[model samples]
Target: MEENATDGLPLAGVTVVELCHSVAGPYAGSILADLGADVIKVEAPGTGDYARDWGPPFAHGTSTLFHVLNHNKRGLALDLRDRVTCERLLGFILDHADVVLQNMRPGAIDKLGLGAAALRARKPALITCDLGAYGRSGPLKDRPGYDPLMQAHGGIMSVTGIEGGEPVRVGVSIVDQGAGMWAAMGILAALNKRHVTGQGSHVSTSLFETAIAWMSPHIGGYLSGGAMRRPLGSGVTEIVPHQAFPTSDGYIMVAAGNDNLFRALCGAIGHDFAADARFATNSNRVENRRTLIPLLEDIFRVHASAEWQSRLDAAGVPAAPIENVAQVLASPQTAALGILQQAPDLDLTLAGLPLEFDGVRPRYRHSAPALGQHNDLLSEPIAPEKAAS
Candidate 1:
């Protein structure tokens, strides 16, 4: 396709009807929107998306989190149960929408006659994605789920946090966002399939499934007769000397991932660990981690993190100082990447889609729409007979 044909954007001609709220479904819609799709976000008539009120840290009179998840789209507000409203939405989908991304409570969209099977029956080329709680077929599929709940239920919590400490949820909504990315990827693949088959497909994903996927490596080890994995704080079971150690001032993470790097690291620290049989190879290091780590820790504490970073760099060992969010945002690397973007029409700066095409990152066209901001699109609703015709 010509670049001018899509305004230099990949999905410029596609239309997405986003019946989503909170995180997962909206996040998927936002990904498509960033790629230049015409996304219309539908919400409840009076209250809008529940995420709109999710914080005291409001921006433009709504939660910042909502803005982050919902920018670059139009918004429509309607009561889906109303006969006329349902008909109007269905008409819009049949005529204009290429994808329907929804995460309504289990059975709700089906009860409203807007499920994938029903919509595909009307327009076989219409793709639909279902972002659900548990999954579509398990015994607990009907139950509502949140990110933390899935983390706990799907065994992620079992392998997180300090080994003997209380359970800790991952600091971010990893499961929800992962599920959203998966849903978006599935839809993209389905769209490709439609180009040849002239038929749509149902793309389904859930937070619980995403959580389980995050535990894949650990699961593999356990199935291979290894003991159940325990949390190692900042450490991983497979690699030694790969965790953070405290320096005189702060912490620095060192990763001596291979035997050569480990030998280099020992030489940099003026240690003879490479000459010791118990620390000669990666396998030996793993077996002797309980003894070796403390010795490295004592050596690291003699100098500051920066000095250690410089020494490790000179020796060609991978090491870095731990940084928080503020430090990360202020770093030169973050500015150079151009991931932070400003909306063209709003006083909002947000992280853009983490991708580039032909040396150009997707630009933010506009901020998130106000509730019902595009209701005029449905002002002249298509009559049932007229729509069918």
Candidate 2:
């Protein structure tokens, strides 16, 4: 047995049976794994996860997405189409597992007799969570959804891109990853409750719900006033001088959200906008954003983005450079945060949990597993070559 990093940690003895694939479901399992749970990822045999083939840029003959979302888990590839294989999975769940989470489409788990109601009835201490696309009770409950599709349905696309520009998906898988985080939160809550009652709970979240949750403030405002809020191209409502502006070389985001900061920002930029009646207060600046913003834009264009960012930082104003993905990955801040954890066995680097306990963040002890790597541990061993044909 390999050395598990979970010794002396919370959830050291917890076993998670993850019947999930792709980003959302797998990410939830990954979160638990990082917190020291023994997560068993059950993938379909043959192709394993469809995401395994989703890359032209494969790492070690597998999808990078698979690698990122699957660290610290033991992989078990099984052909669930076979009755015996499905039975083996459920047997392990009933006999040993603490939590079960799946993101398979609607009716899929039910048809396989792995529904939450059935599983919970068998093991009252088994926590089961379903990560769905739309929801469990909506008219579109059965409909499948992807990250981009959910983004369009959940109003993220409406407010995401440049003002009046063509609708563009958010660069990251916000809906999928957000839903995953929510699932982990729900499971943790349930686990806490279980400690008291010794009973498991059914938990669920959906991509659509995650997307809508992210847009709640904006949606609430629009719904109340019946006035649509247009995309501000990185600008926020009720705040003037809170957007990215082009400098001599690049763009930098600035936020002088209040009166004092506004005055300070004007001084830093060598402008007298604070004295102008039209830009004196936050309300006035908001009202005359068109006129005042262009003036700042003109002044900002005179200096490089680095110079403006430096001056704004020196003045204690909220400011950041509009860095590209590569710059962000290579930044000192990323190194300082220590978010990246090493996986020497898999020759991979993964982002660790975004939090610390006792001043130490958990590290990845296990790299991602090969298909059916742990299948021998089960009574029925599944082979990756046995694709569901």
lDDT of 2: 0.86
Off by over 4 Å in 1: 1-6, 380-389
Q: How much is the lDDT of residue 381 in candidate 1?
A: 45
- Highest TM-score, which number? 1
- Pairs of residues clashing in candidate 2: none
Residue pairs in candidate 1 whose N, alpha carbon or C atoms collide under 3 angstroms: none
Residues 43-104, model 1: lDDT tens digits? 99888999999997899899999999998788889999898899989998999889999999
Model 1: lDDT to the true structure: 0.89
**lDDT of each residue in 131-208, candidate 2, tens digit only:** 999988969999989999999999998888778799989899999999999999999999999999999999999999
TM-score of each: 0.94, 0.94
